[model samples]
Target chain A: MLTLAQAQTIMSAALAHAGTAGFKPLAIAILDSRGAQKLFAAQDGTSLKRGEIALGKAHGAVAMGLGSRALHKVALERPYFVDAATHAVGGSLVPVPGGVLIRDASGALLGAIGISGDTSDNDEAAAVAGIAAAGLVSDTGA
Target chain B: MLTLAQAQTIMSAALAHAGTAGFKPLAIAILDSRGAQKLFAAQDGTSLKRGEIALGKAHGAVAMGLGSRALHKVALERPYFVDAATHAVGGSLVPVPGGVLIRDASGALLGAIGISGDTSDNDEAAAVAGIAAAGLVSDTGA
Candidate 1:
């Protein structure tokens, strides 16, 4: 099970990395395997939209069982599927670069992290840092 | 304003209440003033459907600026309005008994909490317990 403590650790590390990297204010969301959010935070100056977008991305990651980067690739290959998925998830599917799945040492699916409010690449970098700091593996590339 | 920490505290309390009341496993969702999810949790053994339903209820609470119970009353009085709302919010409006608005000390709107998995009354009870535990007032009665 993905504990709330671990989820908080991941979000804290993500925010710290975003600040250190001088990225724009960010919103981050963490969701468990059931696609239920465990934690979420939007920086003071970030647009309110960031929170929903972050949630959409994280929900998509868990729903598809793939990192959003991978989903982005799939979206590129089958654009129509994106529309279908967005409708299927009640407009919560966001195929983007900042959603990553977390796995335990046994490769058990723990949850996912979604980041927004900066460039997708930078947001993803922060998420990766957070997952690593939490001693979890991220399924971004694989 | 409801900080992410406060949101987490509310959700934790709600789940605890559910456990104490011997309700079925549940999914709880907390939404910010902008109707964005602040935190969510699905207790183990709950169906995945609980996640979306929880979100819908929370979104409905925020959208209508009333607790789900009040919204349900409104729905009963104006069924057509409920249909319109379902279309307007991208179908996230669930005029049921598990959503409650959270407010700060100054009576400012903070957000809303939504819970699902048990009977509607039980879900609302848990939400009320959670809002109280967070030291925030709930507009559930109003």
Candidate 2:
């Protein structure tokens, strides 16, 4: 069970990491294991659709049970599969690197975090940092 | 042009109002006038689909240029029109009272806010309170 406190910690730490790294404005989303949204925040200057993009990444990670980094590769190798999966998940699957799965020390899935507004690699790094700060493991599927 | 700060204020106040009024845990969504999501939050214990429902209310409101209260009436009187409008808005239209339009003192549309988890009337009340806290006017389309 990903408690709200843990979700809030992840969000705050993710934004903090982005600020320290001087990344572009970001939108972040956290979804629990069941793919229910837990927390979300979009920076002041984020583009209009960044929130949805961030959410898509996180929701896709949870829905497919794979980090978006892995999904990105699947998208390249099997475009049809990815496309069908996107529709399967109700069009919220964004195959990209910024979505990461959250796990406990026991490797139990807790939730996922997604970030947007910077390069995909940088966004993934921020998510990794946030999960580590919360003493959880991040599975980027790399 | 809803700034992040203002959006945050609305979220916080809306949640606060819900808490004080002893409403159920809620999911809230804010979207800018351009129909872009600005901020979103789902309280602890919110059901899995509450976030989407909240977003649909707000998105539907902005897309239709009317608050969800009006949309609700339309859904009753002109079901086909409401159904078509929902399809037009990428299936994010939820015709209900929980969606309200945000306007400036000058009567300019700014964005919309949606809340779910309580009675639709209570949800609309919370949205109105939040908008007022931000010194904006709320049009429930009553």
Runs off by more than 4 Å, candidate 2: A75-84
True-vs-predicted CA distance for residue A56, candidate 2, Å: 2.7
- Evaluate model 2: give its TM-score: 0.91
Best by DockQ: 2
- lDDT value for candidate 2? 0.92
lDDT of 2 by residue, A7-87 (tens): 878888998999999999999999999998888888888877898899999999999999999999999999999999999
**Weakest 10 consecutive residues of candidate 2 chain B by summed lDDT:** B36-45
lDDT of 1 by residue, A1-142 (tens): 6876788689889989988889997889888887766667777566768787888778898888889998898899998998798898788978989999999989999989999999989989999999998999999734
- Give interface RMSD, every candidate, in order: 3.1, 1.5
lDDT of 1 at A40: 70
Per-candidate DockQ vs. reference = 0.30, 0.60
Among all windows of ten consecutive residues in candidate 1 chain A, which has the lowest summed lDDT? Answer: A39-48
Q: In candidate 1, what are the lDDT values of residues B3-110, reduced to their tens digit?
A: 877887787788888888899988788888988666676666667477788888899989888888888988999999999988987899889898889998888999
TM-score of chain B of each: 0.95, 0.98
